[model samples]
Target: MITSSPPFFVPMNVGHAVVTGGSIEIVGRLAGQWFLRANFTSQLARDAATSLDVIYVPRRQANLELSYEWAPGSAMTGIVTYVGDRFADAANTSLVPGYLLVGLNATWALGEGYSFQAGINNVFDVTYQESLGFPEPGRTVFMAVTKTF
Candidate 1:
């Protein structure tokens, strides 16, 4: 005779979750040709079933930018970004460290609906991982020309 037992595991949504957060931003022109923009965010996320922090939800983040207008229709800008640590799994057992990145870019208008832009990302080539076993990109450079009608 053969006998079968019940399933060992079942997947179902048994509860609900709640999330709350707030963010603030500021943008303004500084002395001379300089400009400033900045923002920050903070949040709390929890899983109802386990009463634990939500997976992959960053609790804090921020960005700041400073720019200078050197010539007519031309500007150079520097950027800084930050991300807070977060969990990679629903159980909150795996943690991914936060990271910061810096970048710089320039834009020049060529007149008559034409423009040129270039930038580099991850200026210091900092190594980071947003998830387990997956690595983020290193220093990257990009350029572009756009024509608007």
Candidate 2:
């Protein structure tokens, strides 16, 4: 007769890892009053032993911003950001899906070395998670006034 035993699992630290990636960015003025800035990044992170992707490392990411200056002291801007999917565990069994976020902001020079600024982040209030069981913030609004000496 032959008997079999269930497989056992052990956790160990990785000795080394190989990560390779590149990023490209562009910034320029558009149409005199409009400005654009964009960037994109892609990367591959793998464990040397198992050749599996590293946990919490996204494969791709990007950001874009467009701003318009309507007046000498006032400007409005829109922003978009993207994060790619990534593994949440060492074995690469759990995956956190990609997410996109949008935002809008404005700034005005109040004169006398002062400025007023306001912005809204996560415009759509999309629900997403970057890590297991941890939820990120959504739909945040902020305002501030500053004076310089």
Candidate 3:
């Protein structure tokens, strides 16, 4: 959707778009319960093109989250991602935009309503920018713990 009015001139933008492909899931339980779900996704972007310049970005990615929960205070999870050809190119970069990244997350219940969680981004410590020229954190370890009354 594109809308323009008087007073202010908003050149051109991607407007809004969403593109998705599909995925498959395989699950089972024996002695303990486990769940694995995957998703295949793509992006639909609008690159403002005028009489002078033309730009467009097409992003393709696939991600998966495999996790298992056993004891009350123990849960482990692994995240994996894969990018298409475009993302592998040096010109294509970004943690969110078009790039290849992998991360992991884990949680602990703490047994008494108190739980702790942690995650590490850029698992391989791969140095990459999120928005082309912008700098993004590398091999970061983020942790947060919470308790309920």
Least well predicted 10-residue stretch by lDDT in candidate 1: 1-10
Q: Pick the candidate with the highest lDDT.
A: 2
Off by over 4 Å in 2: 1-14
Q: Tell me the whole-model lDDT of each prediction, alpha carbons only.
A: 0.82, 0.85, 0.57
TM-score of each predicted structure versus truth:
0.85, 0.84, 0.60
15, model 2: CA deviation in Å? 2.9
User: Worst lDDT window (10 residues) for model 2?
Assistant: 1-10
* Candidate 1 Cα deviation (angstroms), residue 90: 0.4
Q: Write the per-residue lDDT of candidate 1 for residues 1-149, one digit (tens) a residue.
A: 11112232223342576778999999999899999999999987887666777666789999999999998778999999999998766667778899999999999999998989999999999998876559999999999999989
The CA-based lDDT of model 3 is what? 0.57
Off by over 4 Å in 1: 1-15
Evaluation by TM-score, superior candidate among 1 and 3: 1
For candidate 3, write residues 1-149 as lDDT tens digits: 23223234343443443333444544444345576767775654332332111122334567777788776667777887765433212122322345567888889888677989998878997765533345577788999998977
Candidate 2: which pairs clash? none
